[model samples]
Target: MTTEKCDITPNTIVGDLLRDYPELEDKLIEIAPVFNKLKNPVLRKTVAKVATLKQAAQIAGMPVAVLINKLREAVNMEQIQIEQDSEGKTIKPGWVDKGKIVIEYDASLDIENGLHPAAKVTKEITNLKEGEIYLLITPFLPAPLIKIVEEKGYKTYSEKLNENTWNTYIGKQ
Candidate 1:
């Protein structure tokens, strides 16, 4: 399942990219120091598998189009133009008021134990009533989990508190 150079786009998963072009791993970290986490075999096998280049760019605080184009150029592929996704969570949504947060769970320990927190977080969010917010704390952006909750019709907001802490607020729409 090698990815062709021409197919290197925002939708490409980080694991796929590194699997197809291991040489690009270093280039990725060079592009964004945050990508150094890829060096961990556990994360490379877990998070990278589900994280698309677009999400990776967002976590790195860069433009998805720029990240894709840079990787494209590295592989000798022509640059391209792609619209960025909305600048989500830049401003906290109204539903995310701290007073409305009824549940707060930190999944950092689970992540450190090589466990995925989707099911735990999902169950908690599923129990959320209208106007209630669930706060999920993690060591990194829980991109995959966020996508799952969003598909279930939940509005979400994520804020990075530090290099290793992310707060994701989920509310029923």
Candidate 2:
């Protein structure tokens, strides 16, 4: 018999939710197809460790309240409605200029080779000059990295270039 109940909240860590309620993986993917990457053993072990539900929502391009309510709804929890704009951050980065200085790092190869691009990207983002842009190309959305750099004042725009390619633009507004 199943013992764990889905206890997802705004602050829930993505990996913890998956580990505690493994069945919820399907539920999450159903809500956002981009979550399909969570199936990969490597990414699930690495990325999810640092990603919170809030960051996951940002990566999915959904408001935090919306994502939390959807997740809670999926598992029969009561929805807690909050004002829409309370947790807004990256609705759209008006700073992106579509210019050059793109630092393309395809993290899939690094992960497969046992190297993590988070550290490297962190160092690169620290060195970014105003108006400079870094385009992180990865197999999945770099949610944790976005959170870290965004806290340091970088704005971003994320888009899927293809099924296997997600490009996130990180720059200052």
Candidate number with greatest lDDT: 1
Model 1 misplaced regions, further than 4 Å: 1-6, 78-102, 108-116, 129-133, 147-157, 171-173
Q: Cα RMSD (Å) per model?
A: 4.5, 6.0
Query: Which segments of candidate 2 are over 4 A away from where they belong?
Result: 1-12, 16-26, 29-45, 54-67, 74-91, 100-112, 147-153
Q: What is the lDDT of residue 10 in candidate 2?
A: 63
**Cα lDDT tens digits for candidate 1, 1-173:** 85454278877888889888889998999999989989999998888887888779869988778788889888898898785447532345567799998999999998999998988988888889999999999988898898789888998877788889999899998
TM-score of each: 0.64, 0.56
For model 2, state the Cα shift of residue 8 in Å.
6.6
**What is the lDDT of every predicted structure here?**
0.84, 0.76
Worst 10 residues of 1 by lDDT: 83-92
Question: For every model in order, what is the number of clashing pairs?
Answer: 0, 0
Q: Candidate 2 lDDT, tens digit per residue, 39-105?
A: 9999898779878787687677777787788878876789985545555543444576666565666
Q: What value of lDDT does candidate 2 attain over all alpha carbons?
A: 0.76
